[model samples]
Target: MNSASSIQESRDEIVPSGPLIRLSLWVGDRNLPFWVLSIGMIVMLLWAGAFKMTKPGAEGIIPLVSNSPLISWQFKLLGPYMGSNMIGATEWTAALLFIVGYARPKAGLIGALITTIMFFITSTMLVSTPDATIAWKGFRYMNNLGLFLFKDVISLGVSLYFISYYGRRVMLDEARTDS
Candidate 1:
């Protein structure tokens, strides 16, 4: 081959090879929207975390952090502020990792899974029902948390989308590599 052709071949050889790379190239790069969504979650969660730090006056509509009978006062036994602080930090970290696209796929899906589980616990405390949140429709106290639950559902859906798209590509790449 000519020198020019040889140089082109070497450059091509340096390019990434895998289903993830191919899928990324084919998607026309819409990951920016994912980053936005992920960051927005982080900001809100951090605000919640800060509220937890303040204690007795966390600024939020839901009084769940302060007055929910569902979450025991025993969380106070762990230095009085550990529960809410840890929860907030976890949320912030998950969302931050996702926004930066550092393990974006795993972050999205696993983050949602964690949140979904938290919400399920919250719903259970409120209604004493199983994981089926919709089953807790009658009590006024439980109903008050509806908005929070609804938003979590949305988060779950978006996270699922991230998992479905990027996660599948990652898996595909791994599978191809193994073969």
Candidate 2:
């Protein structure tokens, strides 16, 4: 084969063209990532909310709850068990909103807002909780607690995405109705 033909063949190989490419394009074009994030958040929120309602789960989060300035009031007002239950109830409500948001953007926007607040509070635990970090070699490293709290940062971002996505969708929908 001539160099020109070989180059053309190389170019064709370099340019992705197949079922995988088509599938990726389709997934990207549609809002598959957003849906996946939403579904995953819903499942996690449901599971975590259920767990928080349990004795062990409520007991386990004592340190974080007691330490957090944002939510410590709950513990003071309701005590540990009841306070945890209240948080669990909030999570369940947010999860339910997320489920309904699939059909209603306004609902999803509210859910996302709630989730954002939740994550923002939890993420602050990295700084508020003493055991969250360990000083190693004169540098601070995240311990298990810190690492766990750190995941909330990513969750916060996801919630933010949900906020923007749903917010824009709601506005567009309203605009269309008005028009």
Candidate 3:
């Protein structure tokens, strides 16, 4: 082979086109992608909930929760420590349920629905959080914490998607079993 031909052959041999693409395609097609996303959400929920259970974390959020009309009653009823722990417990419950959903299709759909509601509440944090949209400090768009909460909207949407996806699979499986 000529030098140019040899170089072309070497280039062709060196390039890898299929592995990443194939892996992504496989993940997208299978339940693996949903599980992957669920794992991510689980981590976030577990971390946030566990952290909120800590004294400092609970104390830090006291004002924020206390200020919200929707949740303030809880704070008043439970006090800061118990109130934060309650929220943390709720988060942990969601995470645990989400994990179980991995093995059980119907349960997973329920988990996804729960996640959608949880994120929906967090998304509302944009409105309830006092410093969510700090502007004078040059915070715009997602420059502030409020803007950061916007991602929950996407998370909520993904949870809803999982519900539809898993719900259909579960229903189809049930129909097959019945038939």
Candidate 4:
């Protein structure tokens, strides 16, 4: 066979087939992945916000909140339960925005921005919270609290993605109407 045909054959072999092709198509559609990410963020925010409103949850975050320069004032001003409740209310608002954003890209953009700020703040707890890391020999490893805070890094990335995607979508929609 000619080199061109051999290359084509190899390409065909590498390409997805059968059920894999269908799965690939589903992922490639963009909407599925976007909604999946949106749902995940919404669920997390709602659950976490609800938890924070509770006394136990408020107490649980005391150490992290106390150490945080950005939010420490809240604890002092509102005290533990009230301060945590305020944070929870913010989360609930963001979650509601995400739900509304499904129908409106502008709302989604706002939600994404809120989520970005929230995750960024939480991620910082890894550095600010004492005992977040454990020293073993020369290397530092995350403790349980550190591990918990580290998840915020992933959430931060997701929020950023939502921002970019929704931002572009909103811009494109506006451009279409303007033209």
Q: What lDDT does each candidate get? A: 0.56, 0.91, 0.78, 0.90
Residue-level lDDT of model 4, residues 1-179, one tens digit each, is: 86657977896678567998878766865678787888998999999999999999999999999999877999999899999999999899989998988778899899899989989998898899999999999999998989999999999999999999889889878978999
The pairs that clash in candidate 3 are 132-146
Estimated TM-score for each candidate: 0.52, 0.85, 0.74, 0.84
Q: How accurate is candidate 2 locally (lDDT)?
A: 0.91
Clash pairs, model 2 backbone: none
Ranking by TM-score: 2, 4, 3, 1
Per-residue lDDT for 1-179 in model 1, tens only?
A: 66657976885786768989877755534676666666676676666656666665233322443344555453645544566666666666655655554554555556655555555555444343223234435744424355555565566566556556556656756767799
User: Candidate 1 deviates by what RMSD?
Assistant: 10.4
lDDT of 3 by residue, 1-179 (tens): 66657977885576446889767656755868677777888898899899999999898777667667667788899888998999899888878877776666787787787778777877776778776765565654444566567888888988898888778778777978999
lDDT for 34 in candidate 4 is: 80
TM-score of 4: 0.84
Runs with alpha carbons beyond 4 Å of true place in candidate 2: 1-24
User: What would the per-residue lDDT of candidate 2 be over residues 1-179, giving only the tens digit for each residue?
Assistant: 86657977785676568999878867976979998999999999999999999999999999998999998998999999998898899999999999999889999999999999999999898889888999999998999988999999999999999999999889878978999
Name the best candidate (by TM-score): 2
